[model samples]
Target: MAKKVRFYAGVEIDKDGIRHTWSADAWQQFMDSCKKESQAFEIRGRKIAGQCESCYSPAVFYMHLTKSRELSDWPEAGDASGSVSNLATRRDQTGIISILEYTYLLPVSGTPYIALLRSSSGPMPSAIADWVSLKSDMPAAGKSFELQPVLRNDARQKLNESLGVKSLEVRFEGKPDPNSTSSIERAAAEAASTIDESDYANVKVDMSISMGRATVVSNSTEAMRKQALSILTNNNIAKHPIKDMLSKGWVTKLKAKTLQANPESDKPIIEPVDFIKEHLTEDADFGSMKDDEMTPEIILSGMLEAIGKFRKRSNEY
Candidate 1:
């Protein structure tokens, strides 16, 4: 009995800009390609937690999702098409940021990252201290991308257990609250004189991702209420849902990497490892402090470090 994994793969867009569907569609295609490679690649099926399984080579995965209609179905385009030019983009503005987020995962083993790329002067890659992540360039030309939700292995097992993970599909269309403060409502209001108290709002919407497809879900508020989680106990979802998303496709490797010798950023999420490493030279063993009370300040200061060192730390009884 595998648990069903459900997560949102969406890009932010303006509700009125007309590009929402286009953005969502393009991301869907990019994720689809990565999924294909995972299922087809060799090493990805070889090792799981360091054992032979279906495919286990160092694996790499990516996702690209948007809220645009034109770009939504580009995944269906024949081989003749590859790039999505401005002609393929549209725009929309919703009260909400209308953000669309995609997710990608890579094996700890050195592989390539495809969902995102850079100009050599772009933002520093999202690599944690004690462990650095490196990715390869995009496989397609004329298309630019950025990697996000870069997670390691805190979520792989749960993903494998959940088949058709996030395979559920549903769409959403919302009515403006008479007292709502979303920017889109003001725009919609300015366009009309005192909208009818019962006027229904609408947009031509479509949404799809690696494991699911859908249009707008009616009565979105109700839907959300129904979907909210009740018990955090026994819940295995990661703190960052994006990273878990990165793990779905073929995974090839999960090797440990060297840390930066000298860095400027005060934050590397590795303060704990650094603290312990420094102490190890003097206090090689826990001595009598294995049961010592750890303080909140000490614990939170090294949370990022704790997160980094956590790889399949859970033991099965």
Candidate 2:
């Protein structure tokens, strides 16, 4: 089966509390710097932990990670397997490694979007976001930034199709950091301060929308629906924890059109390269092809196509 490639928007926050979309030049420089640092770490002959490596295409990079682990095994059976297994367990030192490729594409004069090929063994979207924040050389960019997912093509549609929402719920614990530069976190902090509590172990916010109505919808109800959809879809600046909960199939008493059957969910998964080639309008050479071989050129081309689609849709919107 082909791996799934997810998309994200590349956002950078400046020192003066301004958010800016990274230009192609800025992204190129950042990746080059990360590649250099990753190379240096590799040369030391120590575990890379997790670092980005340059790919054949400058837009793509391999996130290399090494983890030391212990391998355990049951002792060999002598007379009876049950008796021998209960005697002792053997342990050995081992390590795990992964190389996940990701791509960043920014038009010379437009919005920026990134593509990441997902794998169970690879880093997650949030982890990749953190990697960019921690590894980049740009000042103040790390404080409040993320590769925000464009969920318009997915979750937003579901929300629109929903019969008016009964309620949208989000549960949280503790208080948000007051000094955080993130607008979402700042808003949360302000709300928490109004309660005059230093911390909250468990706080559930359930927002009623249409009072369990379905057919009839009001303007206020529509507005609330839009905001709820935004948070659920990750269209907003910060991702809400409720989004994670929903992904895990958790739901309460709330009822909406979002819970309805989704036809697109049954579609077959396609590899990024295959999808790009099938959708391509022109002949492009990828050199020699090997079984399951993914070259940097192929990854870059596929990601560029994905980003182009995103940009087109964005412009139309």
Which is the leading candidate under lDDT?
2
Judge candidate 2 against the unseen true structure and give its global Cα lDDT, from 0 to 1: 0.40
Residues 1-317 of candidate 2 have per-residue lDDT tens digits of 12234555567767776767666566666655655554312211222245556556645454444322212311243443554432233222112232332333333234455555432223333444545665654434435455544454444344535443434443223444343333333455567666544224343333333444343445644554544433322211221223321111111222233233336863222211111111111122223453545565665565555555555556322
Model 2 poorest ten-residue lDDT run: 271-280
Off by over 4 Å in 2: 15-17, 39-50, 56-111, 137-142, 153-317
Tell me the lDDT of model 2 at 231.
36
Question: How does each model score on lDDT?
Answer: 0.22, 0.40
Predicted structure 1: lDDT = 0.22
TM-score on alpha carbons, each prediction: 0.17, 0.41
**lDDT, residue 65, candidate 1:** 18
